[model samples]
Target: MADYYLAPDGSDSNAGSSSAPFASLQTLLSALEAGDTGYVRGGTYDESGFADGSDQHGTASAPIRLEAVDGADVVFDFGSGDTGGLRLWKCSHWEVRGFTVRNAPSYGVYVFGDSTDVTVENVTVEYSGGDPGTSGAGFHVRVSANTVLRDCVSRYNYDPSSGGGNADGFAVSQATDTVVEDCVAYGNSDDGFDLWESTGQRLSGCVAHSNGWDLDGNPAGDGNGFKLGGGDVPSGGHLVTRCVAYQNRRRGIHYNTAEVAMEVYNCTAWDNPTNFYFTAGEHVLRNNISSQGTVNIQDPVDDAWNSWTLDVGDPDFASTDPSSSKFLHLTTGSAAVDAGTDVGLDFDGDAPDLGAFETDGGQDVTSNVNPVLKAATPTGDGDLAFTAGTLHYYDGSRWVAPPVSYYDGSQYLTVSEGVQTDAGLVDGFERGDLTPYAGDLGSFNVSTDRAAEGSNALKTAGGRSAWADIRSTEKAIPHGSTFQARVYFTDAADSAILRFGVADQDNWLGAGYNSNESGIQLSESVDGSWTELGTAQMTPVTGEWMTFRVEWGVDDPDQIRIRCFDADGVELGTGTTTTSANQGNTGYGFEYTFQYGGTGPVYFDDLRIV
Candidate 1:
């Protein structure tokens, strides 16, 4: 029995049997005979408007079937451009179930190349592509290797790349033995399941939440769920079970470091703020639970506080956002209850839990230990005297800085007890007056310790500007090594430029500079007549204050060169340095502009790189 009739009032030849129904779904599956089964009599099979070499080329021992006419309800949409859905080109043993494929400007269902046994079950891919680039891809599996996507459901297939670039619910690139199990990709904005550089895959019992989309419509970049391995290192080994990634601003599972061998069982990532990061390669995580806001087990390239078996609090379930009508909102005993880990399978025996349900259990404690996680007990006898009460300063970002409207709005944001002031310069800003009182924004030194550039320095009249920018470390001048800078200018402005240098200034060693682009060989010009262009790149140094960037003025005549290259005219390397008016030809002034290139212990920072 063969019956095929698709709306818009029928009749292309009418002979697909059941009632002479034969209006070309490749001529009613080429008049089926091999494993005979053909029936497509729905109402809306527009494929947007059908014409662009209309094709539904299916073949594998004569296979072509699209059944659902006995109560009528099936659809393969094509409302715009990339050509009317159902273009499953390149031969394969196929089975495409109960249709509802909408808007395709790029790809609704496109599986190209020497295609294999492709099965797209109970399909429903909407909106395709919208915001960015063209509107394409709902079920787009390219360069196909071994495909399978079961019980699929992708809503609002947005491609916020307009010309049709960023749109993915199903975009598994460079595929291998692929398997996407029990699927349900919600509100897909950017990444719902954007698995790139593919390999043997298994994404089981899936639920990619929020799936953010609408940056152009502006929801601020919504829930980006499941973006595992970005830019290299995902060629094989797979398993990401029982998933439910909530809110998802950054992660639900984005670990692709080429470390390869992987496994993440019984998963549950709540609130999902920048979660899960690990690499020693061969990965395996049992009974997973990363709670509300930030779960980074390790990744800045290395040292993850000693890798895994982690529990950073609150996985107390019953309320980790779960409810599709199968037991949740559990407050009963709560702290994630019976906890989990069975590898044996228990419908609800209570103890194999860690995410996708399993009796809702929680708590493995993960062996405790977060006692500040060790490493920071070296006060070495303490006591550093600047003489009056107590005021010291040097907080690194690198080499003298203060230009973000100068801090009243607070640009750099980190302070764990660093930055105090006394010894001289006291006016409005710049490293000499010191501010911030911190740790961890970028650099830090006092030769190596007093916490904030010890030895003696405090200058804040606010001209060459350095609410703090410390950098140096080019040996200083070997006289046992230790430089110094202390000024308390009132500043009426006749050029207050104090700059210092050595390495990381374009990677400098000096023939006049290149330690990665230099702080301009050191400059020091204090005026309004407190008169003291200090050492101006002088000589003896191990001064080590360390904290840099915001060298005021902008270039040369007065100093301001942090990390170099801002390019308004271009030319950050070539001489013209000396000037207390050229004291001793290069002695310059103010303790040799904090000295470097002679001894060794000078890592200074707090403005002066023009």
Candidate 2:
């Protein structure tokens, strides 16, 4: 029943108190007793020679609790190479949160050897693994059960020496009753999320994208977005619901090569070359959408209500831009709206909408049109009136009138604005600060040295070792939206490579330089995976600027259009991209990223989103 503190400035000799905290995690773990809570202050911790969790053990009732202080950014940097940042071997009942582990020679966090009831939440693991022809992963759990990994992100982990054979964002093997929810895995050289030789594991509300490519933009791994089962043994009876997989080099949601019984529901797979690839298995797939690729399912039993079978045309989603919160909204005219079979799942319309989300039909509400009232007896509060032509409902206290006009048999009438205005300005960098932008992990500022139109422009710079991005705070692009921007860069050699696009809920869409830096690359980030659309050659002059524009649609993968221009507005290139069927909502913000390592400064100005 004691509390301990670990800070970078404190020492082991002092009592582990708030003011006199232990300087090292090793020292604090040695003093931790069952039911003891350890608070780690904001700082960079270097655990080089320490054996992770070797001396730390807690009971089932009173697990060892290690957490970062509120609003603290705790980072564990394992310089160059190390076995692991935090290792839990043969340990049980431990809880860890709010800590980032990076640059480990092997795994960022490894839980192995019969560990159970271990919870890892709000933890980020990246930049781990350097063993050539060996294995490494951002987070690896093996022979463990009853593990919960929630709200965690794993990215940019690779083993280049092995040519990207064994490195994944998050991997679990031989584990049962494991639940991974609200998790994201992207940008790893290997698979984004993988489960091998595991059964009774459930993955919900998770995303796996842009795997199989190293940070340097080179393909060197297995590259599946979500690999369900592997190994010689059959790993069966897994459940995956409300998950998304896109832009991976291989199959999006793969059953691997093993025969397994699995169930997939309400999952979305888009832009994956092989979207849904399954081996010989007894699988149940319902209410799922695969926008592209050859869906290979062997002996599937409850397969129904998929986007591939519907001949009603495109599902007309709201927005594919991941930057917006509602990227996957179903539009009013979407073929998927109310088209799914009832599987005892609650829905908004007459029936369930196929895919991960159900569109509420609220976005289609127009001004002045009266909704038709249904004739039904009121059984609960706020129930709609069922009487024909009735626009009022009886409340417990009183009758409530509807806000809009009731539907007249002749024509639907509503108010309309006399005129429409031009699209609003998203950003121009005139504020002289990046206060309107948020950084995922990188450095950015307003620069006066270069501008495409004004005296100031947004400048971003980051190391080539990782991904860095700055995104606009406002979501300005809606369904059927168009936007453009002016970008400036010195040259291809500057290593200040940049990618401009829109991101939402772990997915992205945009174009940038290829990892090889030889040509321009058009890509879409589905979930967290990057899918290459097409490539073109357009060399940039040193110290010159270019203009780029895009038009997006709510339905059809072929409706995404992008165009590039020189400083003089000369058309350089134009192309169309494969559209994602399950695009969620509106476009939130304009994003700029220094993808991979190419140090230097990149500038942007005159951004507009409509």
Candidate 3:
């Protein structure tokens, strides 16, 4: 039994022993259905979490391979176990080259795969485990088909859940014509390469950075150091080119709704809290190079920093300063080199600049999503099915509930670009951070900390901002949910909480516990004169960001529907109530806080909730 044995041979280590080979790769998969081309010649083979070879061995025509001697580098170490490192279940024409599959608890080479035509080149899946409850991942390809993950290199991988959850370096699910080329997903917490419910996939010259943004809390937000997208459906042609995502928490190249003929060329994204968070599919982004913060495109140009056919500066890469001196440099008379625009760019020779620093002269905020008269937030939960008009609905358990955004107004208008004015004289501009800047779209004129110091319209409050604040978590939102805000009530009594529901469940103040403890049963009354007095229905939790709506059918979850519209969409109050979610009833939980004060003027949009 001597094909080339070594592991302390007592013999029959499946006959490939000069020594005593075959120490368990399932004893060479029980000697692979009766050998055809067996060669574990060199040694060290234990790729367990590598999907324990999912369906076990294969034969599209006698296809069972494991190489490393044509140029030796084989090193399957999987020291810990629970999942993948080598699993190719119903394998076909399988091929693994110049091996080095590390730590294998999760993935180093897992193609549990069916009908497999796998070919993993120059592979290297390192340090898996980024802590969001820790499950381990460096390569998790599900529903595999026509797979090819080339030139790999997955690094650090540590986000078990600081705010973010889990880690990923390469995830292509529901695969089809898949191709991941010239890869490199660094630090890893989330997307370094992710294409969900995959179809025709293609990623070229890839590069992902510090990686990981725990979202829902705004872990950092941004996906595309290669992140195609999914969930709201859509997703067909997946293609990403010349990539480079720096600081990495958001967009270096991203798509949300499944995405269609997706395309992002000559890429380079900056500090990336958000360097472009796209959702509209059938996508196409021309020559890219975006700089320091914000580039959310929906295609409605007015000022992406400097108005452009292409060309919005500063991506002198090699340094966003991760220290060593520099880390994202590319500056030298930069306007993104020569400014972009060669369209669908052909592997850069020149002409290309939109995002991912090709010499980033990037700063076309596209007007921070510019488009004022705001109120658009239904990326999904129900895929966006809102419009009851007063704020309320009940059909799940029943007990009556509807005011469709509740409002009994006198006057309110908040379709803004006009920053501080609702009369009552002053005070009203604050900056970002609330769930990543409250639905962020545009119009960011900043400051007005609390207004009143002298109140000259609160010193123009930053310059121009509609208003911002929408942060609450520790998740527990029951009863009907609908919260809309774009507001205007020009007299004085201006209020906001388009949707704040959770009528019962312990005071939601989570930093150390604060109190007034927002248990707001219901509130909506932005008076300057309109009347159903807006809504504060089923309000529970202390995290303030008012505009209201809640739908879970029935008034028990503390029943809610506090809507307020008056710009010719009138219906200020046709009330309905039944509040009590029991956090011990105690104190201020808002049976009313839609603030029914004086000076009037209000407006708000997309209040939230299916």
Candidate 4:
């Protein structure tokens, strides 16, 4: 067993001791033997990358450990276009903790190719990918087994290429028995947690929000909060529980076209395109809450006691605002409180709350005296009990106060002298018996008649002369800026109008496909008056499906572009319109309307809002 030291001001030729440390972590890692420990002092190391191949693998009994020095902040700034930061390839039995990786052009911490028993804790990866960068994901694990990431944060990772489609906060591909707990992913350009072709994975006590967009408010990527599965084959029977996803650009918890069954429990989703879009898999969803969003469930064996199934209106959350400290917690008199079936998980009430946080006498509070003196005190691990008078807190053992505040990227905020807010556990369950198809306030029907791609399509009741509308409420377009919506429509009516409407804007942006004339027109309405911007000639045949696309504010912020394509993807017509100052430019919500001159129905399919 040996101990090594690394510091920014040290030299590699000196002895790797505390007094004379090495200059780089790569030098120290190369010199480490089994049962060796390396301590990196507080400083920024501007390096390209660090990797340990299979030849440097450590034994289980004598693992290699690398950690930041106590009471120090170690940062690795891999500036622009580096392949990776802190890479462990085909190695085993390694422990890494307490470090920050910033400005990585690609992945921050990459463990790939048969690495086993690798544990990472209290690490923060931020600003991972940007312009002039390639596709990257923070904390990427591929084909690695027995990997654990605890109390980590992946934030603000973006990939400018592919419109920020490939960058994710945490991506695990074909990793077996990987566990991610007490982690947070925010402001990522793609999905928060993407499990692509990954099996034997478990995600718990994780928070993912504000993904699928960049900091500048540009909408891009799939924007799913938790994308459970994807790839050529259906590759997941993953366990996801006690997770919270909100304000994501797309689905809060998306199955992502996986055919495998996923077990999701005690999760909360809000302010997303669709809270739970489990259309492609046999998912089991229970005790989950879809507050302020839509739910689309296709095939599920066990779906019961969910907020949508129970019809428990609003969950009466403690606070709907994410800026509040008590966001998404079940409050007093909430219908979701104690409305769950015991699924062998811990709870505060007679039963578990419908969502993530259980309100045990309000976990967040400030008191003058000791909270233990109160009749109902906090017992959860992350329960906050701060005494203003004594400036002390219960660290799950005793009351002690630290000198200064320190965030080591762990479950709790630590301070000097190793004082923690509470026990190590941080922000801290089954799916059930029901039919395949479900319904919500939108009253959308799954029809097997005509579909653009899938086996089923959404159908609405026919309207005589008035417009029948289907609006996805709470599905706000990111920044209300540029986006593209595509839908396929077909009907027997000779004269019909299919239009996509912005949520609250009174003006009609344009008609998606108007068969009244032999042309397609993009128009804007001001003061109930319509003005055409551009038009293209095309005559459509009745009873044939055609694709309609609307590109809103794409090139110009106040512009609307429309395109029509035949079933074979050949362009039929195109139109462009730029809105004036009188017309609203920014719109978050959206809807679609269908109107036929005859008393009949128009079928729509494969609706995609991106």
TM-score of 4: 0.63
Ranking by TM-score: 2, 4, 3, 1
| TM-scores of the candidates in the order shown | 0.26, 0.64, 0.30, 0.63
lDDT per residue, candidate 3, 1-610, as tens digits?
A: 1133223222443455534556555455445441233344444455444334345445565555555543233456665665545666666666655445555545555564554677776566665553233345577667778778776666544344343344567877776777777667765556777777676788876667656744232353234466777754556577676666766666665676654666666665667777656756556666666677677666431223221334454444544533211234345455555455565443233554444434324322111011122234575675754322222346678644321110001111122222332223111222111111222223222323322222211111111223322332212233333323323323223333332332222232111001132222233222112122222323222122232333323445554444433444453332344434322211111111223432222222222223
* lDDT: worst 10-residue window of model 1: 404-413
Question: Which predicted model would earn the best lDDT?
Answer: 2
On residues 307-364, what C-alpha lDDT tens digit does candidate 1 reach at each position? 1343426555543313212322224365544455565444464565455555433322
* Native-to-model Cα distance after best TM-score fit, residue 43 in candidate 4, in Å: 1.2
Please rank every candidate by lDDT, starting with the best: 2, 4, 3, 1
Instruction: State the RMSD for candidate 3.
Output: 22.4
Q: Model 1: residues >4 Å from true position, as ranges?
A: 1-87, 93-104, 112-135, 141-146, 149-168, 171-178, 181-202, 205-210, 215-217, 220-265, 272-290, 293-338, 343-610
Alpha-carbon shift of residue 332 in model 3 (angstroms): 28
Q: Given candidate 1, what's the lDDT at residue 163?
A: 26
The C-alpha local distance difference test score for the whole of candidate 3 amounts to 0.45
Q: Which scores better on TM-score, 1 or 3?
A: 3
The per-residue C-alpha lDDT of model 3 at residue 346 equals 37
